[model samples]
Target: MPVCPYCQVEMDDDLDTCPNCGITMIYFFKCQRCGQEFATTGILKFCPLCDADLSEQMN
Candidate 1:
């Protein structure tokens, strides 16, 4: 499960729109080294696949 960024509510991975906040979800994290995109809880500082520093790529 992933938490909705807007409403801070837990949601299913298959959902594109948040059920609690009605906001469209986007994979806000993108790795500059591997070009991988994912949604995170702000605890991850590196790309899971390439180990690239994702501290600055929060958009």
Candidate 2:
């Protein structure tokens, strides 16, 4: 479970937009294996760097 930084509302980890604030929540990610950083508009399933499955590794 993660909270929206802007509205402080509880939200699902896979959500890209805040239900309460109606704002798009872009996620910044870093690959665990390769240490590669990237940005996504929503939840991502894999790391662009090493093609690693990021469902479990991402926050």
Candidate 3:
């Protein structure tokens, strides 16, 4: 199960939007430098853990 970012409600993984808050589900970002993935609500230009530039990576 995944928690909604807006309401913090637990939801199924197959859903793309939260039922309670109506916010979009998590967006995954892969860090090219460290080969790690991050979950965010929107687009991120840099990795939070590695500080790598992620603008070139495909969403």
lDDT of each: 0.75, 0.84, 0.79
- Estimate the Cα RMSD of every predicted model relative to the unseen true structure: 7.1, 2.0, 7.5
Candidate 2 C-alpha lDDT tens digits along 1-59: 88888999999876889999998988888888888999888878888779887888664
Model 1, which residues run further than 4 Å from truth? 1-27
Pairing residues by index, what is the TM-score of model 1? 0.46
Candidate 3 TM-score to native: 0.52
Off by over 4 Å in 3: 1-21
| Candidate 3 lowest-lDDT run of ten | 50-59
Worst 10 residues of 2 by lDDT: 50-59
Off by over 4 Å in 2: none
> TM-score: which candidate is best?
2
Task: List the candidates' TM-scores in order.
Answer: 0.46, 0.70, 0.52
Candidate 3 per-residue lDDT, tens place, 1-59, comes to 87876789997756778889898866888788999977887667789888898988743
lDDT of 3 at 46: 87
lDDT of 1 by residue, 8-50 (tens): 9998766778898888775567788988878753346788999
TM-score of 2: 0.70
